[model samples]
Target: MSLEGFLAASARGGAIPWSEELRAAREFGLSAREVEAAAFGAGLLPARYSRNAGTIGLAGQAVLHASCVAVAGCGGIGGHVIEQLARLGVGTIVAVDPDVFEESNLNRQILATVENLGLPKVEAAALRARAINPAVILRPLRARLDSRNAPSLLEGADVVADGLDTISARLELAGACARLGLPFVHAGVAGWYAQASTQAPGSSSLSDIYGHGTAPAERGVEAALGNPSFTPALAASLEAAEVCKLLLGLSGTLRGRLLHLDLLAMECAEFPI
Candidate 1:
């Protein structure tokens, strides 16, 4: 199948026929114009990218097309994180969340709406992400991350984006990714506070900075004090930016450091690992 054919099939809810493109792309390299034409036809690349389509050449296209990321939550931060990754041309995403959208989530959760109140968060997120870019392969898992499934979940992932709410799950995922040598991006939000960090293999992790697997203080405190919208958005955007940097192999990945933000105080700090 040609790249246009593959994209048309995807838009029609068919499998991504990789063999044809893989063979053709390897045998006779696709020109920048060809890639742009296919991407435009697939609705994957926007008009703005046309001017610089040659910039992300065949190698960059191959890397972006083959990379797969696992996102372990579908709440406020995770939903936005998924959106950003899709827009950035990540080819595949595994979205995991065991929770269902609730009335209370309307305040901050991006996938939460009155129509989707009873729907699973992961499912809603996948639907929205597919709507944005049908070419993206989204695997939505409606299960929580645990020791047994952690390895399988992290398998084949280039990076893991952390949006989990609980400390235990976060720690488990960090350890699992560490063992598998996959990089992980960590982000958390509660009340007027948010923090984010990237954990590369052989480097510090979320636990190293937050102490021994302690639950996010904001979760508990916010139950009594209430969560403000400012923190989640700020933290999620930073996390998304870090994910993009890592995917593009850019510098300043936030690795080995934590970015702390206090919305009420309008202050930000970076603590090294």
Candidate 2:
């Protein structure tokens, strides 16, 4: 079938599930990417995200349909960030993680499940994103981000998300983004506290916030305070929102300012870098 024919058959004056479209695409020997382009070109999107059109609009939605985001670290914040990006109509997402799900990750990692306990975090992220939005292309990389390989992992991305755990790793990612001139959405969570910010090119560097080098500990206070499930989700959501804003050219972003959340005290504030 021609692209128009598939659109015509699939159209009900409303959006359809990506899985349904995928089925039709396969029957017609069409790739999901082709269907995605045709569907977006025809102003059709999954009904699940139709509500976002009011905020992002058709033009912004199209931008999202053509944008690519790279997410570093696929554990707590990384997993949830990838999830929101996929559901928000991001066309492509690259998830990088060198770890796997463990029993300890069950408390805060959204991608962690008993069934996938031993699975690579990136693989789980890919599966979850695809299940949520079949049109979303997830490139899962089972590798840690470092200066040598960060550029390659992050190449061709419009924006890179910093969901990494340690201050050192986050610093590495921010430096990489700076070098590559990519927008970096940074998020961190520990217990009831969470913070997020967007580091646009020439913006404040990560070192300004976390200092010059790696911490002596592998984890932070969160390891002692105990990270509940809600903290990572909350932090990731905030970071994801900044990414969407950057993609759509929205205003009131967290760029150059750190958004801090203290869930226990029910307080929210922003501090300039």
Which candidate wins on lDDT? 2
lDDT tens digits by residue: candidate 2, 118-233: 99999999899878887789999999988789778888899999879887687777877888888899888888999888888755457777755545455668778878999999
Worst 10 residues of 1 by lDDT: 12-21
For candidate 1, give the lDDT: 0.73
Candidate 2, residue 162: Cα displacement in angstroms equals: 1.2
Would you estimate the TM-scores of all the predictions? 0.78, 0.92
Total backbone clashes of model 2?
A: 0
Candidate 1 lDDT by residue in tens digits, 117-150: 9999988988988776555778999999876798
Name the regions of candidate 1 deviating beyond 4 angstroms: 1-62, 212-220
In angstroms, the error of model 1 at 126 is 1.5
* lDDT (C-alpha, whole model) for all candidates: 0.73, 0.84
